[model samples]
Target: MEIFNNITIVSSEILQEFEKLSSSVVSDAMDILNLEHGGCLPHTIRPLHNYTKTLVGPITTVYAPEGTSLPVHLAMATHVQNRVLVIATDNYKSCAFLGDIQAHLAALNGCKGIVLDGFVRDKDGSQGLDLPIYCTGTYPKRPGKADLGGINIPITIGNIEIQSGDILIADTDGIVIIPQAYASTILETAKKKDASDAERLKRVKEFNYNFASNIHDFTSILTKDVAEYIKKHM
Candidate 1:
């Protein structure tokens, strides 16, 4: 369909700012603006490795129906550089639609990260690929080679709608999709939310430190008073 031939990806300085914030902070910011789904993907989608770093980039989408992967291969051939490739696979969980070889190719082609609404394999072997892969789970079966999918088209993964030009910010916590049209407004709120969280964390740490050493609280005093009042009965 040549859908990606003229696609326009909006790159902005606000995206650079978003790179500094966590996904939770970004989701909170989206909530302030009443953005759809609060920019959250499914909680089941997680990085292949536990220590994977944050991924921040523009998006290029693929709609690969269950058991198909030709669209992902086609998009990677030309359109994926410096972008996070998001593939929606009709929520298929029986087998993996991606694997180590594709991940290696994605790294070699300068792709930033990969997100699949389905599953992937070779998580242990793909360790050195250096490209972050987020998916629902891992399986041993491979995907079919049928060319039954589309690139750079709108797709819904776990009820979160995504398009080619969206900004995808993913971290250890989860993924958050920010529409390019509101990047500036969302950035304004995200920075404020991040700062507020930092202040709140600092106060909480100090309170915890104090409470640990001075735990003779009202409950303890009340217990002692009741004990003394009942001493005569004993």
Candidate 2:
């Protein structure tokens, strides 16, 4: 199914604003809003040690075989400005799905980062690179076959079905996949949550306690409001 009519560009403004919000805050924001965007698996696969920037952009999904690299190359060749390349492999055990070379290319193309739900290589090689990369694991051994995958098709990562143009947000906490059509809404909810969090923090600071029980807080925290908000908005 078509998830979005057109690619809605996530302006650097929103991205920058998002970056200002801590990963814990963002996770809490998603939780407060009941947005299903985080909780990626195999947390051991982390953003390369030298990686500093949080990556955010629409998806350019790829699917490839274990021993092939063409799909990776194709995804890079098609990389549009601000896009995040996501790859779902038919074989998660075949080989590394990404490496220094592909990541460097993606960075050169104005892409933000990569979310390879399978595998990728190059920890030392990934250092000093300007891109943020996340994967299931790193493979010291090179990919076995090079002719096995496709790009720009629907694929599932972390067992979540991702379509082309889905919004991918990666930060220290993990990756969150939002359908492109809902990117704006997610941001709106995030914004709202940020406001709420600010108030929550204010109240806690004022109360000097671990919990809030004041009537003002009971109405303001709205932990139960998420369900109602989604029903009203989504």
Candidate 3:
């Protein structure tokens, strides 16, 4: 099946550029673009392992039932190089749908990371593989494996529905998704703003700048009326 739907494939070169960006920068870009919720998945869907590096990639998704992770295996069989494997487990809490085995396979498949709406197990072993696994949490038991699930289809993570090929960026702060249709625009906007954001951080570190000065006018991200209202209030 064609995994992409009228989406321009992001090259590894571009992915490298994105890797240098934090989820916060991308989230800020999404906020400026006014993508609802800024494409954030949810606060609950988080990293399973502590990672110093940011996870960046287009996602290949698996919609798994509460107990079965069969679709993940099938999806992993395909090309996942430099990709993030996202599994929607329907918010099942009874058990972990991912563990060391899946993490190992994903690493072998050249996947850059994993994101699940459900729990995972084998934390020690999975951590040993050095693959970034983002999930709701960890559960020791998963009961249903024979049940069927879909692969490479739209799946809901938190309240947001994520298309299979959406760009995913995660870090210590949180996770954010860039929809395929808006991918290029958001990426460009984020890349451009990233330079200024770095400069802003530098000023903060060097001079204890609180952005109390309105020189950059960070309120530009708001609607004209809202920005005007804030300006008047401030």
Candidate 4:
């Protein structure tokens, strides 16, 4: 699905709230709601470095170039503040598709962070940019003579499928791709899960789970309380 034209502006309060959530917890909450996993590569197998603030938005991907980088960059360069950049290589080539120079340019042009399926050159140079960069690896070779392959099109990185305008959320832990249609519901459910986890943590601290019971026979009571809480709040 295309990004909901009715983009919900993420507020400072919401962003701050997200900061308190572990990416794993958020993913687990998504699973609890039975949301699609979206797509992800093995974090251990990838050497991606995140440099931008954690935020979510529709994605826009670029394929390997067949010409100069400007054509694709200009085509995909957007003013969206929190959009995710997902660029895939044409052939899993060693040639770099993204680098610090392009990342800096994208940041200045108001694009969000980048997730390159291919290599990004100049890792050390990227330390100075405020933009987040996630890539397969770093290479000394800069993107060779732009437009060598192709912007704003669907592509896959590391075999993880991606489409333009799909919601993406990345943090220190890793990335989470949320289908566009599920954005609102996912966010709302996540709020509920966050509150529930907070309360459960409190209970665990106060009562200590080890002292509670062997099989934890209080499920019915807890379920009733949760139902009432949801009814009251939502």
Best by TM-score, which number? Answer: 1
lDDT of 2 by residue, 94-186 (tens): 577667877777888888777776678777777776778877777766665456656667787665677777766677787777666555666
**Local distance difference test, candidate 1:** 0.82
Give me the runs in candidate 1 sitting further than 4 Å from their true place: 208-234
After superposition, the stretches of candidate 2 with alpha carbons farther than 4 Å from their true spots are 1-45, 209-234
43: Cα error in model 4, Å: 1.7
Better of 2 and 4 by TM-score: 2
Best by lDDT: 1
> For residues 162-211, what per-residue lDDT tens digits would candidate 3 score against the true structure?
87678888998999987867877787989988987677666545653465
RMSD of each: 7.7, 6.5, 4.6, 7.1
Ranking by TM-score: 1, 3, 2, 4
Compose the digit string of candidate 1's lDDT tens values, residues 32-114. Answer: 89988438999999888865568998899999885888888888888788888999899887778878888888889999899
What C-alpha lDDT, on a 0 to 100 scale, does residue 140 get in candidate 1?
Answer: 93
In candidate 3, clashing pairs total 2
Cα error, residue 80 of model 2, in Å, equals: 4.8
Tens digit of per-residue lDDT, candidate 4, span 1-234: 112233334444544555556555667667877864464544732435544457555676666644234434653455245666666564455566666667777878777677765666777777867677776676666555543443555566555666666666677777766655555566677778878877876765566454546333334236556656655665
Candidate 2 local Cα displacement, residue 197, angstroms: 1.4
Off by over 4 Å in 3: 1-8, 36-38, 205-231
lDDT of candidates 1 onward, in order: 0.82, 0.66, 0.77, 0.59
Estimated TM-score for each candidate: 0.84, 0.74, 0.82, 0.69
